[model samples]
Target: MHLLFIADPLHSFKIYKDTTFAMMREAYRRGHTLSVCEPQHITWQRGSRVSAQVLGITLTGDPTQWYEAQPLRRAELKDFDAVLMRKDPPFDSEYFYATHLLEQAERDGARVFNKPRALRDHPEKLAIMEFPEFIGPTLVTRDAQDIRRFHAEHQDIILKPLDGMGGMGIFRVGPDGLNLGSITETLNRHGAQSVMVQKFLPEIVDGDKRVLIIGGKPVPFCLARIPQGSEVRGNLAAGGKGVARPLSDRDWEIGNALGPVLQERGLLLAGVDVIGDCVTEINVTSPTCFQEIFDQTGCDVAKLFIDALELAISAGD
Candidate 1:
């Protein structure tokens, strides 16, 4: 199968730590032709048309030093069996534009993972509000008075940007927290973009679990990320330590409820974050944690991901 990954630059990837690299390596081992490009490399040529500069990729035993093929363009992306929208996110205008382009590609018969429409319709953090039973005490609003009232009610809450990913722009406010006025002003100054405020789960000190689900089934392994001292964030990118762990009954219940709907919507892969039984986020845009789980558990999750991708592509064919 010819596979294209729209993601960050190849040179910037830390082969061992990056999930994209792991998947690329598996694709190479399976003898599938792999091409990669960044989101900016995508362009609309004409109506319902798109193009990109495709870089060939190869993987060696020492995962860090992978090989690459000369960059080229196959004007018709449909020539490739599948395309993976693997770019990391701030989920800004540029990301939305790329999704629009991918939507065009889908119309032309190329299978795009996590379907462009689903990604656009589902903002990771906000989507979970639909399932309040699986979530913590949360409120999404831009009005400072409303936010103040929520703080007063919860006493301690976490405030974070609505469009944030990888644990960025997150803050925890206590009963005696300062700068409520200033923080809300900074977050909503430009416009009325609402921020999320939820009751802080103190059990997060033990670590937050990242559970990977593919093809409507939960992967056996999970990574429990322990935050650094005095830090509320447990993202590996934010200096958290990832340790392998098994999912609890609550985790299984959450996955069982969310998985079928996600697969039905064409989201073949997802990474759900759980802290003390409350679902924090459902990551669909290039979810990570594969490498951390593999390193600690010696499980090659990349193989499972590839198998699911292949199954989806073949079904489409």
Candidate 2:
């Protein structure tokens, strides 16, 4: 099978921990041809199928110069056996527009994973709201008074922008309400933008566990991104240490409950974030931690993902 990865630059990947690289390597080990393109390389004309200027690449098994690539050439998205969307986020306007193009490619018969419309519909931060039973006390709003009210109720709260990734712009307000107003204004831009406010789960010290669901099934292990020092965010990008461990019962519950539902919505892969027993975020956009989990638990998450991908493709056929 030929797989086309719509992702960030291949050169930018940290092969040791990059999930997309792990997936590509696993797929290549199984004898699949690989091609790649950035979202900006995709284009569509009024009367033509959506296509990308892609580079055919062969992995070198060397991280420094990982892959040898051919010159970019135009190819219709539908021509590939599978098109994997692995672009990282800020999910800004460009990413939004890219999804529309991918959706159009779907209409042209392209097999796109984590389906385009599904990605657009599930904003990572906002996605957790759907499963309130599994999450902490949460509120989504742009109004300062609403945030203040939530903060007053929770005493200890977390505030973050709706579109943030990698723990950017996240703030913790304690009982003293220190800088709660400032954080709210900063996160919501003085009511111009919306933010997510939740009761701070003290269990964050244990780690922010990433429960990966592939093909509507939970991976046996999850990577726990534990906060270091005085940091509150447990994201790996925020300098947290990653430790892979077997899924806890609550992790399994959340994963099992959301997996089939999200899969039905065309999400081939999802990373459900749990801090203690509460679901914090539902990460569908380029979810990572494949390498960390595999390194510690020997659970082969990327292989599971690719297996699911193959099954999905076959079923579609």
Candidate 3:
């Protein structure tokens, strides 16, 4: 199989922990040809198919110099057996527009994983709203009064921006409501933008668990990103320690419930963030933790993903 990965620059990848690197390495090991391009490389002319200037790569065993690559050349998206969209997010305007371009590629017969339309439809933070049963008491609003009322009712709450990734712009307000007004204004951009506020789950101390869903099934093991001292966010990027563990009963419950449903929507992979028993976010854009879980549990998450991708492509044929 020939695989094309639309991801961030190869040089920037932390190969040890990067999930896309794991996928590429696994696929390469299995005799699949690999190519890579960033989202910016994707282009579509009025009369031409969506194409990208991609580099054909061969994975080197050495971590320091991970991959050997061919010079960049233009290729139609439809030519690849699979195109994995692994771009990290702010999910800003450019990312949004890139999805449309990928969607056009899909129409041109490109088999894109986590389908372009599905990515647009499911905003990581907002996606959890669809499954209120799995989440905590949450509120999304731009109105300051609405946030204040929610704070009054929930006492201890977490306020976060709608598009924040890696735990950015997240704040916790206690019963005293310290900085509640300022946080509300800051997060909501003084009524210009909307924010999400949820009842604080003290279980965050246990870790903010990332339940990776691949091919509509749980990965069996999850990476529990536990917060360090004085930090409320348990994101790995936020200095949290990642500990891989077998999924708890509640974690299984959430993953099992959300897995197939999200898969049906063309999300070949997703990361369901769970704090205790509640679902906090449904990350579909580029759900990760593959290497962390594999390193500790020997689960071979990348193999599972590539297996699923192969099965999907073969089924389509």
Global lDDT of each candidate: 0.85, 0.93, 0.93
Candidate 3 structure quality by residue, lDDT tens digits, 1-317: 99999999888999999999999988989999999999999999999999999999998899899889899899999999999999999899999999999999989999999899999999999999889899999999999999899988999999999899998999999999998998888888889999999999999999999999999999999999999999999999999999999999999999899999988989999999999999999999888999999889999999999898998899872
Query: What tens-digit string does per-residue lDDT give for candidate 2 at 71-92?
Result: 8899999999999999999999
Better-scoring candidate (TM-score), 1 or 2: 2
Query: What TM-score, over all chains together, does every model reach?
Result: 0.96, 0.99, 0.99
Model 2 misplaced regions, further than 4 Å? none
**Candidate 3's error at 105, in angstroms?**
0.7
Poorly placed runs, candidate 1 (over 4 Å): 62-64
Off by over 4 Å in 3: none
lDDT of 1 by residue, 1-317 (tens): 88889899888888768899889888988999888888888776666467777777665576546674675765556768899999998788989988898999888777889799989977998888878999999988888888899999999888889888778888888899688777777776644778888899998987889989899888887888889987889888788888888888998999888888888999999988999999988899988988888888888899999999999887882
> What is the TM-score (0 to 1) of candidate 1?
0.96
Candidate 3 clash figure, as a count: 0
lDDT (Cα, 0-100) at 188 in candidate 1? 65
Q: In candidate 3, what residue range of length 10 has the lowest lDDT sum?
A: 308-317
